[model samples]
Target chain A: MTLAIEPITPLPELHRGRSLHNVWARFVNRVAVLLCWTSALVTIGALFLIFGYIVYKGVWALTGLEFTTHFPWFDFTHFHLNATFFTSLPRPGDAVGGMRNCIAGTLVLIAMASVIGIPVGMLCGIYLAEYSKDNLFSHSVRLVVDVLAGVPSIIVGVLAYSLVVRPMGNNSAWAGAVALGFIMCPIIARTTEEMLKLVPKALREASIGLGASKFQTLFRVVIPAAASGIITGVMLSVARVAGETAPLLFTVLGSDQPIFSMNSHFPFFHADLNNAFPSLTAQIYKYATSAEPEWLKEAWGGMLVLIMIVLIMNIMVRVVTAKKMAGRH
Target chain B: MSDLPVMPPAAPLRRRANSAWLRFVDFLTFGGAFGGTMTLIGLLALLIGTILIGAFPSIHQFGFSFFTTSMWNPVTARFGAWPYIYCTLVTSLVALVISLPVSLGSAIFLVKLAPKIRFPIPSALLGKSSPSGWTLLNPRIFVTVTSFLIELLAAIPSIAYGLWGVAVLVPIMQESIQPFLADSVILSDLPLCGWLPHWHVGLYLAHIPGIGILFADPAAGSNMFTSSVVLAIMVTPIMTAIIRDVLAVVPPELEQGALGLGATWWQAMKLVIGFSKMGIFGAVILGFARAMGETMAVTMIIGNSRPSSYSLFSQGQTIASLLANQFNNADTDSERQALYFTALILLMITMLINGIARVILLRVTAGGKHK
Candidate 1:
């Protein structure tokens, strides 16, 4: 005696019957997917739009175009490369010149900030990653670092003003570097800690088993293992501080000449750390807001330069990390 | 015992000497690192102390009224932080509102939809025969490139954004978007309010009281709304990156289970979102804090107007912007102190937001690990 078996049937609502509930659910799903696609496209599109506009306007500015009566079109006859824009000092009083001084000043400021921020940040990160155990002190220190990272650049400027500028009775390059250093410190420390933490425990143990001291192991083995990541972090932090304008507004107070000078006396490579310094971002701000079109053009050019520096650094870091990731595979 | 090798006495001494040197080096490194950590602590204390000491005069003078009153007469030396606080909150809230949906949608697209998406490629182009006529687009590559661009957006300096805002966005807002919005508000009052007024889909939206004022006429284009838009653009990438990270951490098994249970892709996403709601909220809060503290871009376009009405079309000043604009120009010590007081307020607000976000995110990630 055999028992009869029946085939399972689909739910009436869920079948391909074009039921209202099924249709509604499908419609909703389609709409959601469509929205997501549109949003992603829009985000990418917005980035492209920004870059496109910047490049167009920046290129126009770089070529030193003269406005023609053609209304919105520039005379290509005047489209010569503006070499003076990179080589000559900024000309005052309606004269269009270069941002050489400001560029130099910016480079000097970044150098000073890195010098002050990098080692200290790396050491703090080393302590957090290798030495300090989970304790209240370490926890509090981490908390402070997190909080400090969130503090606005303008506030840091104010702090630097009071802590460095007011005591010295002047806005100076030193004060600006301090403000930027403050910004760079927490970022470097955070990244360094994270990168160091990523180094394998087995490697550390191997070094220890080889009779290496903790300090030697960390410096020679762990740090080297994490070097690429640490360097990437440092580069990113430097890029971030490079374009900071608000802090420099209060600290460096823009200058017209280069912030450094050569002296024949002792300390021959003299720096104007005691005086006002110009920076690319701050100078761009000053020029961009001016009523003069030439100044605005220069501002655009300066922006192009600044953007190039930052984007190059970012892309380099990305490429390096990508290579490292690929190599791991 | 007779076969045991003899050890050199000089070798033992050298070994001892090396060990001592290593110990000394270890001590030095430890001391240096500890000093660096202490420096960080000292920096924090110094930051707080500087702001506190600088702000004491205003705090003493105004007492609690500094936060309550709206008056800010520099001539009379009467200062109030209420207006700046209000502006900061309003702008940041508006920015958050504008950015949240976009960021969420993009994040969902990235984590859920990206992997399933495939592009059809012609066999001729590929130089190979394919039965399905499709090629995997490598979601990993797509996601990496998209995220890299988003990060580049964030890497673009605030000052650069300000430059672009002044040169490009402001004019566009003044000429097109603002006028269109204002016109739509008027057009919504017509009989065909529901359908004819294309932009006035916010007809019922205009009936809302306080929010209605936000859709007012465009001034110089450097108004609160414009700044809020800039802030929105500034923060969307950050919020999207964070939300994508959080969403990516949701267990794939949970999503797969939902799908296997005959749920649609959207339904699966809804489940994942519900699971990671706390983390998403934390991302929003972090974005809000960033918007609040953003200075140069907002300052360039916010019109730097002192405390005015709450109209989004009206120019307003935020705490950070106020500090940026006035900190340098303050002629008197009290005036400088007032700016300090504003900075203190801004600091507190940001710290509170960041702290709450950190706690929520920590808990969410920790909970995920436990699961």
Candidate 2:
């Protein structure tokens, strides 16, 4: 068979007008470069501006431990109340109270969420990466994970409210944890999958060649290899959920006094997890919107703590990932 | 070794028990992983199903008019979503308009103009000629630091941004940007100053030919403009990061080919961008989806008022802010149902946006494979 080839068409001449067009093009390129530089500067500057102002305004509240330890008191109507009373929730004009309960409550919520989310997410991720062999089921699961990650957090709140809070006949930390757990699941699972995918297939095959079962190979070799990435993903997921307010809005229901501490209970050691609890994020929303200045100040204090928690977790993840990345070379 | 161990194969019960334990573990782990995957699918279904079921009362009540009617009074039992939808779209649109160029420019700067960084230890660190700290002063360090700060900005909670917006951004907008635009000769002439309560233009500005300046009755603080500004800041990092990643993955050969043809650096970048337009579009849509669902900051800064406006300067409510403000305090069943309906709408929009973004991203990768 004879092969036929199409004739090449002649190309157009260059439109290199030496006078005006060249100048215009040159000017455009220069301006574009300048704008790009300016954009970088603006982005960097914006970050520092937000963080600086927050730290500047929030540092004073943070310096005192009162906000973190002192529960607010409502009835200081009698004379000569204890100085510790100053750490209680703000009265109309007093700024002495702290978000101790909120701090405790946030930790409890996160702990519960981690317990639910981490294992399940890791398992799912391992299955996706090491097993399934890119089946239609696995593809759909991956798609669903991405879509779930984008669900507006408030809708998650609403879901938790209906399923857990409403059914229980009250808002509780349990419901809040569930809502936050839903949010964390997709992030951890997807990250874990990606991290596990980066593990060498040769390692898996070698383990199998050594007569190791699939589970043993995964647990002994693949998982340990991808530990740093999985840990980083876990940290990032925690950071992501730590700042979430909308889900907790309808779930935790924000209490002023500490309710969930084990010491503050009837059994003396058991804490009530299924009760309305304070959270730093929910507290910020509550106090930030209050009519009183003292409450607003407390809100700022809560914001500082919240920011620190999130930023520290994120920075830790960054450091870990960066170190691992450096080690790869 | 065989002589030592061969004597242990006598007990059938023990051997069967050993195999049973192994089988149990095998069954347990495989089942656990499969169950975990199924849980994720179940979680999505429950979330969407609950929202839809919760929203059914209002959806049945309002039917299609829910999209058209702007009325949202709880006292009168009237609920409509035109204003909230309008505000959500307008705020997201405004944020995209403000952020797109900035993020694109910054991404281009990092991906094209920034120097390639090598994570090499300085020679002096190994007791050689170079100084130990020389790498600290590199310009690539500056770029890395900038990018780190951007990521940190992303990590910042929406509430903190809200706090900053309330404390800082609102004042700046009210004092600086608004007034600057109001007074500027060219910008002031751009129809922003005269959008009155009834959508009528100012008679004075209207009478002047080619000058349809629409000055909104400026609220003191916490307006649509402030919320949009915060939203813009909140989303810039996301857009910039995504675009940077997208551009990073664009094969250098595309640019090298253009350069080999004697094209300018700008032209080469333009060609690369042309090739990655779908990816960039996906990035923009992702950013928009993020902007639309952003809650605390927008709610805190957007002045969550009932009355909506056509102008940016007036206080407005997004669907998110509206749901946030009213969901918990909703006294009546219909009121609560209406809020759920709003969430349903927001959910559908976000899902659609993300779905489209994913499709675009897939197409970009598929196209790359062909090239």
Candidate 3:
């Protein structure tokens, strides 16, 4: 090949007419950069606003044993005021721990929902990611999951009201737990499925080459490796459901009694599990409309408590996600 | 015995049984997932069932005019949805107009611009993801919150929103707009503000003609404008988060490649980010879907008027809100069926939205690896 030299253009002077266009271009890029930053800053500011206000309010209300304990008094003067449904505290103090009862109830319902929801979601996710080979079943699951996510909270409430709450009896957390699970399942499944897909096929092949069955490989290798991502997704699902109102409204029937302990009721605790209790979210709804000062304090306090809980969960997810992302790099 | 067994093949029945068992387990696994998926679809059915049971009878009595007629006189048992439908479409359309720019802009800002902006996550978190620790210091909190409040901002429950509109928004709107009217003569001509009742409450004391403003008449319900605000708040977080995520996925490499080729930054983003046609479309569809399914919050603020409105400030009803408010009152069988049909319509809408979103998301992901 014959050797050839390319001519180089001379640099233009900054003050000349030709430079004006360059200057304008540079200015535009700078402004674009500024616009990007401004948007991000504004978004951050909004988050801080939500966090600050909730914490500021939650601090005082989250005090005493009350922060942890206390169920409201559900006086169904017209309904059944059966002693069987009621549980009394040891001390019989002036005020029940407002949040303590709710905290327990919330945990139990959320935990139960999580248990039922997470596995199904993961499996559906697995099928979508692996077995799908991009199948019709998996594709339809995506559409269904999307619809589920968008369904209004009230409609979920109504369905739960019709199915679980009506047939199985009412004024209990089980109904609420099941309803929340119905909605949460779609979100957890869809996200988990997507996250699992992001794991390279090579990793799974490596596990299979070790003479592992698909089940063992999936459980021992793929799952544990994707553990952090799944955890973050689960946490987000929790945070999302934590704010839900209508579903619980129609399902739990809004009890005001101190709920059973979270740990004790696992597997089966008939009396407590069957018992009526309040959720922090449900309480916020009930108390928002009340005329009493004491109730008002509880409502605002509950909102603060809710904000804190959701924020903490969200932050943890973000941190875990960030760490997992960095580890990938 | 060992020599004979060593050369023998395993029994065909046993092997077949084992494979069958394995297949059974797989089927079980798949079924468990599909069952939950069905529940998601099942909810739409339940909602429709409830509404049709409640509203269908009225449809029979009122005929097809049940939808086309605007008059809703309870004493005469006359009913029509002309006004309600008008109000819903108008406000939602207007809301779409106002929010689409801000939300889409915010989405683009978050996706393309967030990296250059430090503390990007916090901004997204401030409203939803994180707590409000940093926001207490910003002066914009006052401005945004006040603006939101004037708009009855954030995810405050519906009851409070309704009360605020009744107690706060009405008087302000009435006083602001009434002064421009030509007393009775000019006011009489305005169809939009025709519903304002003479009664005054809280801050509104004037007997302004036409409910053109907030408290102009305070007829119908206080929710008129209040519901629209609530709807706006309810959908904003959803829009912001989804759009942000969609934008975030637009590869930086693509944008940089354009810029490296001597393209303007605008040109770079347009080519790179704008390529996310499916995602952007999905985000918008999902946003509209969010607005459609929203019930309690919208119910609280929207006037939930018997009839709806033509004007911006009048009470209007949404399909979801209507089902929520009226589903329980239907005692007749067909009355309930009509309500169910409304719910069916709502469900169909939701399904259609999801179906579209699924197609868009799939198409985008299919193209995700491309520059």
Candidate 4:
């Protein structure tokens, strides 16, 4: 049997008139589109402009003008990396030397913060994702976490001062880490919960059907599957807290000496958590606000380093997330 | 047959022992997680408690007059949060004013315009599209790069912004922007003249009883206006990201349906925006909270002066900046308590704003999912 197909007729075009309403609507659409494009360009342009200015000033501060003596010709001798800027301790009376202590202090503080933050955050995330069923307790925890995330870092500093510093009788790395950890907890928890939620329900059911306990299933299967995402969250949180200056202001209080010192005996490295700790952000604040011109240059250099670290981490996370999204599809 | 059926009651005791151990482990893990969550709640409570305790002395001394009075003389021991509160509100409101339109426009562009404009690359030059048909140079990639750049703005340390404000923005504002605003006759005559203070006409209108004291001669580079601009820049990325997410969640069919019914692109956008208006409002509130709590950058650029006037170009202080400047060097116990009192107020304001924003945002996003 042959099927007969009828020829299709296109619908007649509707009357296209330049009425007042149509014209006004078209004009508004065009204006709206133009405004959107302009705003996007402006936002991107501002980012580039700020980044460009920073890079220019930062490079000038880092490399100095000594290379100008051999301008118009290639000379490798005068162009040397600012080694002293990263290696030596900051000098007094004159703002000279490097931010070695600050860098080391920042690292120590971050390590301490991660130690306190990661487990608690991950566990709380597990609780929310695997156990809670929209109950009041879990609901309140979520709300509190959101609120904590929004609380000003400076207020956290005040909390640290009152809770740790006042009790300890001085500013210390412990207090700084606690403040940073407080900031990191909610961020880490939020991300972890989100990541865990992304894992398929089938995976959990399969593990459970295999006779694995809930705890075993979470630790052995679900967590492993979501490991990379959780790591990304942790790194993002680290990047965030690494740049926090206010929270460290009264907590660590800024020091010229390194937070850790080498000892001659076994377990040689000693961390002085009892005293003020040097931190990159706190030191940057100090240098930027100081009266010395050289200190300002140092501040710029520190900012360049800090920005590089943060941007690199963020870019890495973006790339990972993009890859994961692509892979999922 | 009896011997086969009797096959050793399946090691029931040993199986029970193993199961019991697993149950104990599960209990411990659950307890640990519960403790962690409890710690978070405790930490928040402790934070509020500490600030309240610290501020108690000043709260007792000043009474409710602290909220109404503007006097903050430390030597005389008379303290009030009125000026700081006023400045904080003004700065945050100004920042919201500056950032909202820019962020909304950017979000609209990213969500609406970007996906429609296809790049005409040879399919052969690019690999075969994935199952999802997304390729390099697709809208997703463009949006990703743009969003990443925007978020980089957030990742920038506040102190860096402070340095940039002091070294770069302040000079520009002082040399050009402030002067232009102060002298511009058109701006002075704008319909919102009550709010848009000006220098040229402000002098004549100063005694008119209605004109604002916002615009004045540029004093130092660091002033209320400059700080507000910095805060606007700081909050723009956050607002843009949230607004973009909120807009993205609106079902494409809604906009398409509007367009299919012969509506313009702007009209369709208006429909979608109307649908998610609560979410956008929440984003604005979130940005406002961020601006209110911002400390280091505002401190660096706000001139850190005792608040005296509402002039846009005049030096002023916000609660957070005041706390940053004075918390360390607070000479007297009363002064310290006063600073804490101001901090407690800031904490309460930000938390309240944040809570409201989160609830609104949650409702909107959840509603979208349900639909």
Candidate 5:
């Protein structure tokens, strides 16, 4: 509802408007406003300052692209291994070393994680939104999901270490992917449920009216309507797990050397998911805490790349959402 | 003969086969969806089960003393978690104390103030007043960017914060804030303040050590206070976003009614906040959970030194930090099990807080319907 639009008034005249009649009331109101304004400034300033400082240090250290790429076959330093991807360990004061292996490892693990996570999370979401009735079972399931969302990442790491790493007799990318997949599941599932909930009930009814089964109605009509939201949720889940260091710390355990040791016999066909690998986030933690200035610089650069990926993903979500809204209109 | 042809019976058989195939597909897809939900529940159960089983060795060995013992001697194999637990509580509490007001204030600013001043000046009154100055300070540009900036802050990894804290904030604290506090007369000159500055309590609270160390003897700047500051900054985005969301759903009519009844904008906001108190509490609890479980940054900055001290300025070890620091190097079975115990504790705390928050949030949403 529109209120009557009044002309602009000076502070005193606005105070005169019966809403804040007394001088003390006006003073309190003004002070409250000032406090809030200052808080906004502080919060925004802190965010930009952290990002700006990282970029500044990162750009200064980014003298060469050497640190980001490694062509293992071309380098030909070791036993001429068939697996041609590895993250070279950062030697003290070594300027030539890069995180090619870490980047590749991160991509591989995330891809594996998404393959496992997305379908399961999306399916769970569909079940919650469409299939489940409001009953004791549904309530318990919801409670479980909520609690799972809050479980610490470190704990997840420990669980992975015990469950997968120990049983396999080795730390592996598969274990890390499983850990990351667990972290992604609750977030994706919850968001997907919410997104699907937003799909109009009438859409389901219309599909059913057109002689469609419940499965067809959900898959063809409701899912397409909520597709963008689900994609956003998936992207967000990937971004969330991409920066997680703790889960990977114990599971993948991080390698300094460039190694893609998944089934070596089938290089083209299989990834040795059972081998340790480096990741960008784990490298940042390792390098940042070290005393060497060179490693620290590389850490800053890695952090910069990570922040960019996360920001890009977040921005895409907004852009996609905006486009979807425009399309609806 | 026309009604009962054998060819028609053949057509019916074919249609039955197709329908049966379709039903099977439906059953398969339904099972897939159902299995996904079951998997989520199973994962949660498995994680908790693993932690509990791993924790058994430590729990069985230590008994009740596990909570009471202060020493964390790996050599003696005498593991006590009291220090780390204490550190977690102190840092999280301090972070909440610092961040809650600021986050709430920012939420209020975004929801209440920004909208009121976003309009263009009308007619000749625009130039007479200082319109440019007003818009420059409280511009639509500033408001939009501020909201987006909060989300960006949340997107940043905790390790980055740790890195920033160690590389940047550490020196600033060591060179400036710590030394300044140590030299300041506020601890010496003020009445009953000497004790107050250090969070010192008297004989009544004997469980606490003498003259609580919140501001006691200063060491290197990597201390409880520093970690708390970092945690505060880290969780502010979460707190502000949650509060803002809760505030958004508060019926505008409630606030408008307050305004119509001669209350100011700030007063109306207070009404909105009061109405959603349960939700705000839940949000703060969630933030507290975040602060307590935060690892990389707290580990990097908090110094992770042994012999835990209460001094906010002295080095301390949080449960999460202790886990992160020692997990890789835990050589013996007992040491590793003790680390598992730490994880179990941290997990329990986080889960409990989240559970409480969920309940509170449910109540808030349910209550909002009545109003």
Candidate 6:
């Protein structure tokens, strides 16, 4: 249909038809160009609109002090004045609590995820890179990783909640960490394998020539060289885990109370078992869904806080890589 | 048995007992690596197994009936997943259709048309760069600003979409669009012909044919079109991002060769760019997958009123939303099991589709690598 308007074989004939089909030709060309641009623009532009709306609405709720601090402490009179911002200081079980507990829970959960996920993922990467030979089993494993990534995190949450929280009869942070760990491992292993593969065979030969054991060569020689890529994988996984909400919702059984203690005093914080704690993402999910306007504001504020933390982590990764590369000078 | 030759030994053996300790290190490296791999594979199996078990009882009782029944009466022990599955399929498919063209278009422009984006991070950091700029541009695509925006939008709960969809979209799509189409004699006779519900008391009469075509009388809330629109926005960024990554890998030579042959840019793209249909299709499937998986975003906009929908404007229920709305409300084991069966089915379907896509993508990539 589009090809009927073809140009002439020679320049003279092409010129003759120019005026008759000039506007039509230009219009066709314009639409063709616009079609491509519009499609791309729509893709990029919609993201902008969503962000614009979120930030525009959320700005009203954000305050520097509120961001740095947990839910503010206030009495009944203050609560009446700003009915949305609720903080019951004296052991009020369920009014509106600070995010202190959630913050601690998220950190502990993340720490556990790193511990459980990293070593195993790193080893898988090595095995895939050094052994397996992309055999049927290894190929199947690679396929499984993609499938795992596609599995909705909510399923992960449901699974984790059942395995860790429901059986234990408590909403502890440990279960949530395990869920996030499951999500993180496939991604980490793939990245690690790619990095490991980049290490030249000559380096291994050099080490072997010097009478170094294969294990020592891998650990002392290959690993140190590929440290940047491995770390990058960890950093990316961390960023991903931080953004998740569904997994935490079921596993963490988030709390409103401020939990300031970083170390043990909390039995649930131990590595031996699963425990529940609050995370910023989970809190946002709860608060945003609530009817109160004040709660909505806090959800927005919470978003800002979470984005900042993720941003900082990303910057840390970038800066470390940059500095390391520069130091080679 | 074929024995692969090791690199010819180049170094002198240390004449000490400790010299062979290095070989032990090699053994440990291989052992630890394999062990770690087994643990990860075990974790994946464990996760799936755990969920399947929990959902087992429900699966056993309902069998096939669980999918067809919509009673959801926990007090009497009746559970049906028809509504939830319908909504999930409808909403995700709709969103995929809406987002696919735009995402693919954007990806092509950014890759083939737009000038290469240059952000000079120090040169040494560029270890093992791919010839394709697709992966290179990932860092750029991920500038926190984009994700930051997505994160904020993501945090907005689904209920808001419900409130907004009913309040805003139902009226706009009905009031303005429907009446304009009526005077043109578009649909003189259609079942949707009706009066719309006004905010105050009256019904504004609308005469239109199509679901999107405005009618004199507005249809009730929970139309499929409105639900799909809201869902389209939610899935757009995800689809776009994934599409962009896939597109970044297309060889520039394909486009260049087309242009060199004197074909117009558009013609070149249609022929050469379209040939990599596999990757583009993978992207749309990714969008489809995300749409299917998304819970909160579509849940809000979809009018949760049951009795499955054929009209684009009527309310419908999706499987995930149905579970969410009813899980806490379930009083009977039968009811709960029906939900589990539905979820189990959803999980199975998703994994199967994803596995197929991965295989196709791997084959394409491996072929490209070999070429």
How high is the CA lDDT of each candidate model?
0.85, 0.81, 0.59, 0.86, 0.80, 0.63
Q: In candidate 5, which residue pairs get closer than 3 Å at backbone N, Cα or C atoms, i.e. clash?
A: A67-A98, A86-A258, A87-A258, A262-A271, A262-A272, A263-A272, B213-B311, B214-B312
Model 4 agreement with the true structure over A190-215: per-residue lDDT tens digits: 99999999999999999989888878
For this target, which candidate reaches the highest lDDT against the unseen true structure?
A: 4
- Per-residue lDDT, model 2, residue A64, is 38
- For model 5, residues B278-357, the per-residue Cα lDDT tens digits are 89999999999989998888988998886355678878999888887788678788888888888898999999998898
Off by over 4 Å in 2: A1-18, A64-95, A260-267, B1-23, B117-143, B182-215, B366-371
- Global lDDT of model 6: 0.63
> What are the C-alpha RMSDs, in order, of all predicted structures?
5.5, 7.8, 11.4, 7.2, 10.3, 10.0
lDDT (Cα, tens digit) per residue for candidate 6, span B1-371: 35887788878844553555655766777889888878877766876687677678877777688778766666777677776677677777877787777666665665565653544443336654555532332334433334334433433334343434544556655654433333332332323654533323223333334543323223554455566777776666565565555555667788789779655667777775576778667666766666676655445556566744454555777666555555434566566566566667777777777887777666655565665
Give the fraction of native contacts in model 5. 0.62
Best DockQ among the predictions, by candidate number? 1
- The C-alpha stretches of model 4 lying farther than 4 A from their native spots are A1-15, A65-78, A93-95, B1-18, B115-139, B185-212
Better of 3 and 4 by DockQ: 4
lDDT tens per residue, model 3, B229-305: 44554455556666666666777788888978777777787676577766877867776776667665566556576
For residues B132-229, what per-residue lDDT tens digits would candidate 2 score against the true structure? 45443334765677788887888899888898998888876776466555432233333454443433222343233343233355546788777878
Deviation of model 3 at B235, angstroms: 3.2
Q: Put down candidate 6 lDDT per residue, A1-329, tens digits, no spaces.
A: 56687666665445533574555655665676788678765655654554444544444354322312334533222222222333321123344434545555567678889987787788888888877774788888777767887887667766776677767777776787878888788878998898787778888889878866667677889889889978987887787787776566657756655544346575543342334466777776676656666666666655655565665676676667555545554
Model 2, position A235: C-alpha lDDT score = 90
Candidate 4's residue-wise lDDT over B295-332, tens digit each? 99999999898766777778899998888878877888
Model 3 chain A scores worst on lDDT over the 10 consecutive residues at: A82-91
Model 2: lDDT of residue A3? 89
- TM-scores of all models? 0.90, 0.86, 0.68, 0.89, 0.84, 0.76
Please count the clashing residue pairs in each candidate, in the order shown: 0, 9, 56, 1, 8, 33
lDDT of 6 at A288: 60
**How large an RMSD does model 2 have?**
7.8
Better of 1 and 2 by lDDT: 1
A best-first ranking of the candidates according to their TM-score comes to 1, 4, 2, 5, 6, 3
Estimate the TM-score for candidate 1: 0.90
